[model samples]
Target: MKPLSIITLDQISDALDSIDLLGEMRSAFIAYSSGRSVIPPVGELIIDEQPPGEVHIKYGYVRGGAHYVVKIASGFPRNQELGLPPGNGMMILFDVSNGSISSILLDEGQLTDVRTAAAGALASSVLGVPGARVGIIGTGVQARLQAVHHASALDRDDLMVWGRNLGKCSLLASDLEAHGLKVEIAESAEELAERCRTIVTCTASHTPLLTRPMIQPGTHVTAVGSDTPDKQELDPRILGSADLVVVDSLSQGLVRGEVARSIDAGTITPGRVVELGQILDGSNPGRSDPNHCTVADLTGVAVQDLFIAEAVARSLV
Candidate 1:
């Protein structure tokens, strides 16, 4: 029997630096949408205690892949108050040939954060305008990753950011500036949306932050929050008014995310939603008109976890 390999957070982060994270994420989405991967629906546990938290169980396997992965990640909004990080979790990797546990990736949710940010960047590159200034909503860890990943992917340094708390927004802007991005702190979500053509929302808000009136023509919105049925970031009407609406997974989108909320509100129909994989695979025309307002609601799929875990594991080897 082969000994199990235990990987730490630092090792995982270092491995990711050398990996083509965006390309891996792009492939994950394509495989999932093309029916080349087996990803079960996400299992979630919502904590209603003070300073609420949520735990997500996401796992999957790619057809003909050497390993299967099960990832457990969590988010607690007020963890900073307790002098701890907001996100934490790990991934378990198993060998497919012998059904043996091959490795334990103690990433503590860093993999999830990076993979999600990579997905956001992928969405921006495919749907957004070239050289457009990016707007980021929310000042959480995901917000910082989204800004950094989008900057790297789009090859743009200018960013506008908005958050409910001004102090956190300032901190995030300073942190982004250290990464060589010229960051602008917006006074409000509306102000941020008004200034940038490409917007990424990575908040934990249960209410709508970007409304229909705030979005301009030729704008592309990539929303990575609202992974649960109750969490929402965009006004459903904004999706209804979008010329193109894309999701990471049609099955996940119809049950959660902005698409589900919009459908519940009778603003958008499921038939109108296109999978990002379809666009990547060239089966669907995405953003036929540059002036079209596009929105991508990503609820975070398990295949993403599988791909990132596999990539990190391979890099370590």
Candidate 2:
């Protein structure tokens, strides 16, 4: 047994910057959706302590690939009150050829942040129409990353931000403004929805925040907050009104994602849910018409971790 390549968070971030996250994630989504990748159901642990958070255990492998990944990610929203980051995680790589432990990436969820934002970019590029302004909900790392990524992907200079905390919302606007985007602040999530054609929700709220009537025609909603059974950021009625609803993984989303709640409430159907890989692989048209309301529920997938780990591992010495 040789030594494990203990990679640091900075190293992983640098690696992430070097690759095209959307491209890599597109391939992974295609493979996983097309049955070319194997991913089991995610394991979740919820701690009901003071902070109140959840940890996710995910593992998956690309068929015939050299390496696989197992990721343990956690999100504690109240950690900000303790002057710490809300999300943290690590990834372990394994060599399929020898069944040996390959490397350990202590990214502390940085890769997750990047890949998730990349997925948002993908969703925006595919499901949203041209001439649409981007609106963001939640003033967290994901809101910043997604705005930066989506601004570049959509080639737009305008966006809007909404959050319960006025300070954080202003901070996000300033940050994105420095990135060359004309960022505005919305009084509420509903106002944000009405003002922009594309809305990205990234909060950890346990209740619905964005409702149906607030969303207009031709709007695209990217729901990234509902990764577990207890979390929901979009109202179920919104899914019912959407012309098209896409998810990263049908299996995962149907069980523990926002889509699950929508399904349970009889607002949506399995037949209406389309996997993103279908659009990535050109099997299904992403947005049939420019006026269609599209909602993408990305609960995060194990294949995403496998893809990112493989990319980072290849870049390591």
Candidate 3:
């Protein structure tokens, strides 16, 4: 038997684009919520040289879907010294009925970034306000992916960005503008939030990066940071005021300190939250009114990783 071929981030990116991964991820999430998959525990700070590790594993087959995939990934903060990402991972794709390895995908930064951006795109398409003026609250790689995905999903051309470091934000704005987007750099997350109806936060902060007052009524926010327990990008008040707070997975977020802190503080109730998969399945309504606030808290999910792996495998065949 031939050994699984090792794949790189660039290959993953090409595969992701070719397979229309956003739609695939959306369908996979809905099936995941319907009890069709086994999602494992996610441990945060494992990679940070902290107390524990953040590990996630999941196995699932698309409903009326032909394939299954499982992914295991870990984020270790110490990798920075090697000029490498703290996160490194691989995925296994299998045949649906009889579980057999179809392909293996080896990716670190590329896999996570693509799937994360796809989730934001799915959320934007399903819940963002119509004709939204988008705002980005970071200029990192994930931020760039978020900008592209939002543009694809919303047909939006207007984007405003902000970063603590003005030079980085300015450079990012220029890059996006070159991509045919109307990009602007704002002074703060508050300013970006105030100017756009759809806001996406993709930062690596341990504290709140945005507040409630910055958000207008009818705004939709997708918080892509906070994959670890110690990181949070949105204020607790925003959680309390949201008409709907959608998360990629309930079990996953509770492990991360972001939602757990809010829940522990009594600022938000776990019962009031809905999974993005449930919303996609029509089990719960996504956005009931244009005048309401909605928040999608994403801590990342194994299901997404698996789905993307399957897509990449198929493209390779």
Candidate 4:
């Protein structure tokens, strides 16, 4: 036993700097879509706010050639009541040769947060119009990651933020401005949606935060909030109108996604759905034109967990 190496979030960031983590993530996803990999089912246990249910766990494995990653994430909102962070997680990488544990990365949810944003950025880079002003719904952890990740990907400098809390949005706007980028806090989601063609949502809302009327032609929206069956962040109409709809994992989304519910309701269909991996591998079209409306429904994936694990393992300690 190597005593289960512990890699912290700060160390993970340093590791990312020394390698092309984003490129690795992109390649992993593309390989997944190309049918060269297998991602097992994600098991989730939800905690209702009413009773504040038990802590939930989601674990999975992604096998890509001689490498494999085992990922586990646990969330307990009630941990906040106990004065602790609500979410915590770690990943274990296996060499696949002799069944030896290669590395254990304690990402502290940073891998999930960052990889989710990076995937969104990759989707935006492939689907969004160049130099598009970005719109963000919710100014939480995921929102901050999205802002930085997408900015890095698309060379976007203008950001528009909208949250239910004006003060928080204003704070986020000021923070981005301090980074030498232009930021605006919108009064409403509709206002933000109307201004920017590229929208990313990362709120913990169960209801729809964005509506069809708010969207404009050529807009690219990535819904990263709905990882469970009961969680939703965008209007069903948005899915109905999107010219190109891509998902991180079709099986995961169809079982636990807002878009999946719409597909089940006949508002959207499986035929209209595309996988990001397919698009990345050139097996499917990404963006046909600059004016096409695109939507990437991200429920997260096991492959991403593996991707981040590889990134952390190769990082200099």
Candidate 5:
């Protein structure tokens, strides 16, 4: 067995910042959805269900690659109560030929955060309205990165953030402000959806935080949370109202995301939900009208982690 190269969080952040992540993510999605990559069903384990935190074990290899990746990402809402970050985990790379471990990315789940935000930006790039204001629900790492990556990728400056905690929301806004990214704090998720043109719900709630009536017509929503069956951020009715709904992958979305909940309730059919790759591959037009509501549920596909983790590993070696 070879000694595994451990890539630290600092290295992970630097490597991620040094690449065209959103572009890479787009390519990975295209490959995954186009049958060019291998992504099996995700394995999950709930560590704490109270505030709803769980660990996901994802593994896959892109065809024609020398290495594959297996990532274990965990999120615990009580971590903050323990004075630690709510997310922690790592990704391991293996040489496909002999199944030997190649490297370990101890990113502390920063890679997931980056990839998730990159997916948000990708969805916005394809479906977001021009000069539209972006809104983020939740005051966690995802909320901050959504504003950062979405603003950069979509080239939209106006942004707002909403959360159940005013202090956290204000702090997030202030941090973004210090970086020249102006953001306002919304009183609630409902207010954020009504006031902002585009919204991304990044909460860890087991219940729906953003409902149907709170959303206005022509809104673009990227639901980044709810990767587990027990966790949902957007109300299923919102999925029923969307003119077009996209997912990182159809298979994953049908089982765990808001799409799953919507499907189970018969609010929307499986055929109604499409993969974002189809939009990128020119097979499906994502959102044709700027005034039509669109929704994209991202349940954190393995291809994303595979692509980015491999990229980070390559940069190091």
Candidate 6:
């Protein structure tokens, strides 16, 4: 039996610098939507204690791939108060041929964050206008990642951000400015929506923050905050009004995220949605008209974890 290798966060972070994360994420989505990967529904546990939190268990395998992956990640917003990062988790890799434990990646949620950011960037690049100023809603880790990723994707360094906490928004702006991005603090989400053609919402809000009336035509919105049924960032009507609606996983999107909310509200039909992979693979059109309103409801897919983990494991070897 081969020894199981355990990797740490530092090593994974270093390895990521050499990995083409955006390319890997793109391939992951294509594989998933093309029926080349075997991924089950996500399992989740919501903690309702004083500091609310949620844990997601995602696992899956790609056909004929070298390894399978099982990822466990958690998000506890109040952890920052205790001087700890809110995101934490690990990934377990197994030999595909023998079903034997191969490696354990103790990334502590960095992989999840990066893969998600990559997905958001890729979606925006495919569905959004080129060189459009980006707007981010949220002041947490994802907000920063999405800002930076979108900057790199669109080759634009100017961004507008809005959050409930002005202090946090200012802090995020400072961090992004250090990355060479021109940051503006929007007084409200409505203001942010009006200014930027490409907007990425990364909050954990249970209620809608971006309403239909706030969104303008020819805008592309990426909603990554709503991974659970009860969580929502965009009003259901936003999806109903969007000219193009995309999702990472159609099945998952139909049950969670903004798409689900719109469906439940009788605003949009499930058939109106298209998978992001379809756009990547040229099976579906993405924002053909500059005047079209587009929305991408990303719930996070397991194939992303599988591809990213496999890339990290191969890089380590």
Pairs of residues at least 3 apart in sequence or in different chains that clash in candidate 5? none
- Number of clashes found in candidate 3: 8
Taken over the whole model, the C-alpha lDDT of each candidate is: 0.93, 0.89, 0.79, 0.78, 0.87, 0.93
Candidate 5 at 150: error in angstroms?
A: 0.9
Candidates arranged by lDDT, highest first: 6, 1, 2, 5, 3, 4
The superposed Cα distance between candidate 4 and the true structure at residue 117, in angstroms, equals 0.9
lDDT of 1 by residue, 101-206 (tens): 9999999899999999999999999999888899999898999999999999999989999999999999999999998899989989989888999999999889
- Looking at model 6, which ten-residue stretch has the lowest summed lDDT? 60-69
RMSD (CA, angstroms), candidate 3: 3.0
**Candidate 3 global lDDT:** 0.79
lDDT tens string, model 2, 1-317?
A: 55679889888878877887888889889999889888989988889998698889999888888777899999887988999998899999988777789899998888888889999888888889886999999899999999998888899989999988899999999988888889989998888988899999988788998988899999999989788887899999999989999999999988977899999999999889999999989999889888899999999998998888888877876
Cα shift from native, residue 224, model 4 (Å): 0.4
Q: What's the CA RMSD for each of the models? A: 1.1, 1.4, 3.0, 2.4, 1.8, 1.0
Better of 1 and 5 by TM-score: 1
Q: Which ranges in model 4 have alpha carbons more than 4 Å from their true place?
A: 1-4, 48-64, 78-83
| Predicted candidate 2, C-alpha RMSD | 1.4
Candidate 2 residue 102 Cα shift, in angstroms, is 1.2
The TM-score-based order of candidates, best leading, equals 6, 1, 2, 5, 4, 3
lDDT of 2 at 67: 77
Candidate 4's residue-wise lDDT over 94-125, tens digit each? 76656677677887666777788888888888
TM-score of each candidate structure, all chains considered together: 0.98, 0.96, 0.88, 0.91, 0.95, 0.98
Residue 16 in model 6: lDDT: 93
What is the C-alpha local distance difference test score of candidate 6? 0.93
Clashing pairs in 1: none
lDDT of 2 at 127: 89
- RMSD of model 6 against the true structure: 1.0
- Looking at model 5, report the run of 10 residues with the lowest lDDT sum: 46-55
The segments of candidate 5 whose C-alpha lies over 4 angstroms from its true place after superposition are: 1-4, 48-53
